[model samples]
Target: MSALFPALLTASNKQALRFDGRALTYAELAATAGSLAERIEGAGRVAVWATPTLETAVGVVAALLAGVPAVPLNPRTGERELAHILKDSTPTAILAAPTDQLPPALAELTRIEVVVAGAADPTPERTLPQTDPESPALIVYTSGTTGPPKGAVLPRRAIATTLDALADVWGWTADDVLVHALPLFHVHGLILGILGPLRRGGTVRHLGKFSVDGVTRELSSGATMLFGVPTMYHRIAESLDTDRELTKALAGARLLVSGSAALPVHDHRRITAATGRAVIERYGMTETLMNTSVRVDGDPRPGTVGVPLPGVELRLADDSDGIGEIQVRGPNLFSGYLNRPDATAAAFTEDGWFRTGDMASLDADGYVRIVGRKATDLIKSGGYKIGAGEIENALLDHPGVREAAVTGEPDADLGERVVAWVVPTDRQSPPSEEELANHVAAQLAPHKRPRTVHYLDTLPRNDMGKIMKRALKSA
Candidate 1:
């Protein structure tokens, strides 16, 4: 109904974005985006060169200003993945900075170079075009775990609702400065990390690349908030005991949030012990921007992602043990997959709840603890629906274990048996299979213990520090 980022028109600040040592104020950004939006105002969906750069932000803003839904193309995307996205979205224009060279996959599209701010706003009276809130804003693709990744059409309403809900939960305000170094292609970086702050009329300092020094510098200097994936936080937790600057910087921050993947309880405890600040975890997916999060004022539960957001209604479908596939209904839900009507229809239930394909359980207080994904993380063994995440966490609790992933394998007798893939802290003095099995058996049920154990030097992880469980099974 109204403009998504009203701050761009009202705010006069000159520090809206601090990207790669370059800063653009709200006035400069609005001018740059408005100029670009005028050129492609009537185009179909556009494809973005989603690099972690100031120009990338400008490109996305321009698309939004023009009411053109953009498909963000990851710079590191493989040829196959790139091909699928290009064929599916079929954008009319490709947006990129002068420095970015187009890949072979984008050879078929019409390319347009993204220009940085030119001079200043000549006419501030011409505001962003008011578009329908239900119109598609983005066509974000999934991780392609099942098949060729489907384009989830995110509407303007979803973005506005999710950001407003987060603002209320985290006590976020224009005075707060957010700092992060996450990739720009995904929701975590593009929406929450960048747009979230801009919507609140706040400043964002994005390290072109993440470094402990950058985290220390930004958080210690003026940044009030930090958003990172589990991998970055793990490194921070590991070094806190040795790095005084980092510990102090983290301690002084107003808030620290982790998402994209679950943060291990061990890392959480270490960070809290070192800095006396708990890292808040939130749960969501490509289809749903955000559903649940540990509120800034709520108990800093080590392992659980706290209650559902304001408009989100969640239920565990047919699960009496407080655990099942998480089904949700909210304004934050995506419209549907771009052109795949059948697939999108199947994503929702008969009653219209979107089946989140994620297995989770709610505590007595309504905090959500995600067990794992429905496909890879749910291990049905001997009539028990075992969550691989619990066993993985228990294994992580062992001092000798470094990394662990659990999966189910075909077993004639039990239908499916639990298998453990472990990376020991010391290979030469690795923990015996018997000992590790007993360790899990003691923590959980003996039946849940690994029937077989495979040791590797390292676990296969994606860019976000998420264990690629599917890769492990094939490995």
Candidate 2:
């Protein structure tokens, strides 16, 4: 198989990456990562202290060059979760920037400082290690909503196939430059945002921390694309009415993509109305890197995740009322959960389709509208199945509603009752429960209206901006 980043193997001087104002050309990155690779070439696996920094990016690239699997450890992870990941992956060494204070759990591992300043080799002559397509390249851990986080072993082929498919669908080219402020631990930020640009020999500028001003500056200065999650897009939508520079910057960009969680229809309308740039959405999970995305040349359907990517098979299992659990099989899928053969076997069907616990309905044009998760988003009340996502969107349409999340509670009459958790735009003058319920009932069906409403200052969310519904249920 060829090198994952072919441009790195060359001596081109084009800028490949920029983080926190520090820029690196392809020639510099190749030499730096090559030098680092030689230090850990024989390791079985390495752990990268995944921070939004240049060193983290160089470290992961170095591990790939050495044909060693890299495990990205989230910096904000809880102590127990971090301990579990280290125990599970059993990495022989850990890589971090010199300035990072080592956590007690990672203190015992062999530490390697990734320094990018003086490692550049203008002319490099070392032969990069050849790795098989099926070899593991990354070990990304899931959010572990059910139990301890499970490591999803992604292979070189999965990464290559996904990026290539996205290039074809997005019309991505080497001339493009991407701007984003997404976290580096998740696949959305690391694989799609960072690695995707590298594979195309393009440039990526990371925002260190996401801010509307930072996004405006980069997009206004010739960035071709923007990748973000729903939370970030929500913030952008809120600022578009007040920030003229942001509106102009987004309008000038060639593409805007949202993922990790579904972007609300309300936010989609706000952004598109202000900037004339409809934000396209994609659907995938830890097990499957990417399955479906809205095409660049096709309709930017506001609420749907377009169709399946090239060379992927998708199906709906246990259909009812035109909605069912999504199942997929593709080269973009991870090899399996690391060291958990029984769990891995259970994740797949007898025919080899990976069972994604998300539920969605397919449109006539093969567009996928994700309702919610099969476990948390599906609600059954009065013998009618309802998706929390649609109701939440409807709630957001109200002028007084700022944020909303829906869940089901036990009901003596209706097997389960729809419950709403809301954050009002004006805390002192929040919308009444009856008024909000009526608003939702008018938009959707009467049966889908919330039976109980609870007010909150904010909804719980994870690093990727996904609403933590389980936390709401527990609360």
Task: Give the CA lDDT, 0 to 100, for residue 344 in model 1.
Answer: 92
Question: Tens digit of lDDT per residue, candidate 2, span 155-261?
Answer: 99999999999999999999999999999998999999889999999999999999999999999998999999999999999999889999999999999999999
lDDT of 1: 0.89
Mind sharing the TM-score for model 1?
0.97
Query: How does each model score on TM-score?
Result: 0.97, 0.98
Give the candidate number with the greatest lDDT.
2
RMSD of each: 1.4, 1.1
Expressed as tens digits, the lDDT of each residue in 35-103 for candidate 1 is: 888877888999999999998998998899899999998888899989889899989889999999888
